[model samples]
Target: MKLRVFNIIKNTKVEGPGNRYCIWVQGCSRHCRGCQAVHTWSHKGGELYDVEVILDDIFNQKDKIEGVTFLGGEPFEQAEALGIIAQKVKEKGLSVLCFTGGKLEELRENQINKKLLDNTDLLIDGKFIEKLTDYSRPWCGSSNQRYHFLTDRYNEEIFTKYKNKVEVNISKNGQIFMNGMGNFDEILRKVDLMGIK
Candidate 1:
């Protein structure tokens, strides 16, 4: 159940809604021009850990985090493993968000990717288009990419429930951040409880 992961950010604000634990899986052949995780492009560059161990850590931080974010070296490449992890996170009552180089439609067609997205709350998808680069967007590196609300089909009611509540941010300096569905005070409280730096 273990997967190769380039890195793990126990507490991050810009990755997903609220303070989230971001898992950066290793391996991506898509090498977009401005790829931030250049080091993760190689499939053989990461360390492996059991899914249970990663899940345990995330669940244990529930009281201190609003959700979990999956980043990549193309998470969909290990969609099966991602699905396993997502299911466990869902059981913990925390939402899941993912970053990918694949289009939502393309991923939806893949059984494994769909399984992972079944429990995903949001997806920031599309490869980095250097020509369409825009730093103003939330959770996306380039303007060509989009933020897709996959939870419950991006409907009105669902939108209202999550609207303004969940926000992921990326600083100009490449610092990732997330503001959970709850307010800033709640996020700060969770951060304090987690003893996160």
Candidate 2:
């Protein structure tokens, strides 16, 4: 199966617990307000890669990364393909953390999400509400967003163990990419003022 992908970071610390291989899948129907990844909202916008290719990349970094993260364009949008990758990674003792704009209740109703949900170690749900924005928690930016510890791999301890942070990745194309939770625009503004670009 093929998955539309916006970008993939082979290893990153701020996205989830420890070092993680993060996949930002392409296409989000829910255009949540103040979404940082507006570029990923188009269905036809990103490159497509075979599921096997993504899985191979994850495995290649297995020894270095603690797990893999599926964030998007809503991850649930490409649930089936991600489910396959999620399950395979779990078998290798790699944890899975997924982010979604949809509620877990609604997602559970769809049979397509079973494997992905079942294997997910941590699932962050709820759309980002700009007005309710609060970065007190890890990863998520809104007070409304909730974290579900789907498995024992992670839990309430994350509140103390991790903090919201961002990583600046200068991609192979020389594009400045930022990931994680924070005031992205302000950060970019500072970067611009610094004459870094």
Against the correct fold, how does model 1 do in TM-score? Answer: 0.77
- Give the Cα error of residue 166 in candidate 2, in Å: 0.6
Off by over 4 Å in 2: 171-174
Please give, for residues 1-197, the per-residue lDDT of candidate 2 as tens digits: 99999999999999999999999999999999889899999999999999999999899999999999999999999999999999999999999999999999999999999989999999999999999999999999999999999988887989999999999877678789899889998998998898875
> Relative to the unseen true structure, what is the C-alpha lDDT of residue 186 in candidate 1, on a scale of 0 to 100?
60
- Provide the global lDDT of candidate 1 against the true structure: 0.77
For residues 107-148, could you state the per-residue lDDT of candidate 1 as single tens digits? 888777777988888888899877776555455556787777
Error of 2 at 91 (Å): 0.2
User: Which 10 residues in a row give candidate 2 its minimum summed lDDT?
Assistant: 168-177
List pairs with backbone clashes in candidate 2: none
Task: Return the TM-score for each candidate structure.
Answer: 0.77, 0.97
Candidate-wise lDDT, in order: 0.77, 0.94
